[model samples]
Target: MKPPDARHSQAEDARLLTDQNELARQEALNGLRQFDAVVEMVEYHLQPEHRFRFRPSHLLHLHRLALEGISSYAGTWRPASIQIEGSRHQPAGAHRVPELIEELCDYVNDHWQECTPIHLAAYVMWRLNWIHPFTDGNGRTSRAASYLIPCLRAGYLLPGKQTIPDQISQNKKPYYEALEAADAAWSERGTVDLSAMENLLAELLARQLVEVLDHATGGHVTLPSAKENPSS
Candidate 1:
């Protein structure tokens, strides 16, 4: 390996950047704390036991429903009822739904050795959004599950931050655009390929993991990538 590309250089920056005093650490911890609770609710709703597990807008709607006490019956899946996309009222691709997530799980389960779980998770998320299965909240739901897998992986893979949107969030629209652009590519060609996706995903995760390492550790590297075979 040629070390990480520049896009993946956050770890090196982290090593240099995290020697701040207690005050800075406190500030960072505070931000992480707020973010933590938000993600927790998001991830819990992602579990299969949630009944609405694969429903596209379920996660996003659940967030508002849980925190704001918004009223609506739960787990109803219909094009108009559960929509998610840049444009409203547009039905997602045929593959966009809980099955897309299940397929991601299946892919990661079998190919952990061949691909980084973080990268695979990112790709899965990308596909989920493109499918645009729901009528309302696919982005938030995919975003939640994307974060959730790593949290689960951290519990199982290593001792690091459970979520990683910090880095991904640094450039939000670009991330969304990348995914949407890939979808556009698929629309033109009528196919999607995971390998083409991995390149973008690798850049996203290697950097995002480094950011998560900082975010969860009060700006220090408390939780490293515990993944046994992280490509890095």
Candidate 2:
């Protein structure tokens, strides 16, 4: 098999590409693979006798699984600075990644009870993006981490036909806006404000619950104009 095209490389690794069409195809396949992985991980954690502890290693492993075939630096932090295209936010310096990620893990584990599930999930998603730890697949990994938050907190995997990550992927504009809002709050006030992201996630989870319920009852339910309440 020929080496995958690297004409649109996004990182030092030539294997990471930015070709929209190819990237889209790879992402679709990767999303499915990651979905299965999330289910398995959630199930394993939910086992009656198992004790689940949130760890930075889980996020690293998720990143590895998410970009397994596309990026050579899938599970590793970037060795050089990265510029997020079209975003004003600058991620932490490469040298600070380990410390930052350790801090994130500590925050999540320590405050797991103080915060709501949506708040916790949104924080993970935004903080991961802000860190930009990996050379690639940071968004996917963060989104997966977001999903894992609620599951781990609930002590059971949440049921849904369309997960929060899937919803975020379908229409990223609002997701980006929410993340940007959180970023702005952090930059200006030196505080974490995840209200926007939490609201969006709450909406997505509600939609997922509705969809799952519809399927469970064998009913084709359609809500009011999706524009008024976009789920996808």
Candidate 3:
């Protein structure tokens, strides 16, 4: 029985109520496609044959892309603002940027084996954004970075992983609201509570999961694919 809103948007309502297995399957595929697109945008390889094993070089390349594409400036890296609390604001030197980049890479490498791919992914992304390593595109870079976990996780856990930018970007009020909320819960130094960060990620992940499932399992999805991974 379709609900009153069901007929209006089949893609969205298709799986308003579906079995757990079917929902999981559809989401996997979406995750794969989105992850592939994002990585490809920055000339990163997916290595589908390997089931999306995350490579450091590729991940770094993707992060650079997000930093480049998402930032307001095309090819520069500096503090966008005083950074109310994004990361640190100690007048990072040009050379220091590379060092900071390494730190981020090292963090990912260190956690690659310790946490759930999703947990690692979410924390890295949130932390990266909070770090605001780049002057511009910090938002876009962070988002792309975040996708890595879900994308790879999907390959390992599900068939495909879909993009969640659309679901998350919706309603600027809630979008920014979530960001603000997460930021507040985060330590003044920008360090976040993993549990809180995970919860926030869970909401986005869960919503995207639904959208992916809705159209993924032989149904039509309503949310349009992110035209270009969000404007930043």
Candidate 4:
């Protein structure tokens, strides 16, 4: 069988790409595939007997799916230092990535029972982004894994038109601000504060569910608009 068009030839290895347009196209395609795979993963874990386990391997799988045709470092931890553009917080050194990721999974698994779904989801999102494990696709992988947490915790996939990650991707200013808020708390007092991120996810998740309800009822129910209350 012929390989998928997106994975054909030069697209098979992003390192060979020189044209900016091809790179952009491939990234977009990879992103779609990544999200589809994430949804599949969530569905698999939603089964009655299957339980979700937060692990470094899951993160790497998501990261690989996220950047399969965009970077050679797709699934592997970076071997050198990295920087987060437009952010003052310095990520852990490359050598520290493995340990940091392990700690992240440990935090989620350790707090799995005690924490609320939103809190756990927020922690996964913030801590994974804070770790910045890969050379690229960090945000995408983080969002995918975070979304998975809530779905697994609920024992079923969450209903939505636009996912929490899709909402955040559409408007990143608030997402970045929430991340910075968590970072500030962490840096100042060594706290794992994720209230800002929790609130953000709560709002987005509400909006997503509202959309589902609206779709189900054929738009008869007029819910308050998320657009009008941007500050809320």
Candidate whose lDDT is highest: 2
Please give the ranking of all candidate structures by TM-score, highest first, separated by commas.
4, 2, 3, 1
The parts of candidate 2 lying over 4 Å away from their true place are 1-10, 16-24, 218-232
How many clashes show up per model? 10, 0, 14, 0
Lowest summed lDDT window (length 10), candidate 3: 5-14
C-alpha root-mean-square deviation, each candidate:
12.8, 7.5, 15.9, 8.6
In order, candidate lDDTs are: 0.47, 0.82, 0.50, 0.81
TM-score of 1: 0.48
Clashes of 3: 14
lDDT rank order: 2, 4, 3, 1
**Lowest lDDT 10-residue stretch of candidate 1:** 5-14
Identify the superior model by lDDT, candidate 3 or candidate 4. 4
Q: How close is candidate 3 to the true structure, as a TM-score?
A: 0.55
TM-score of 2: 0.84
Q: Judging by TM-score, tell me the better candidate of 1 and 4.
A: 4
TM-score of 4: 0.86
Cα lDDT tens digits for candidate 4, 1-232: 2111121011123364668999888878877887787778888877767777788989898888777866787888877777776666788887999999998999899999999989999998988888777776778888888998888888777888699989988887778888888888899899989998999999999899989998899989876665787575
Which scores greater on lDDT, model 1 or model 2? 2
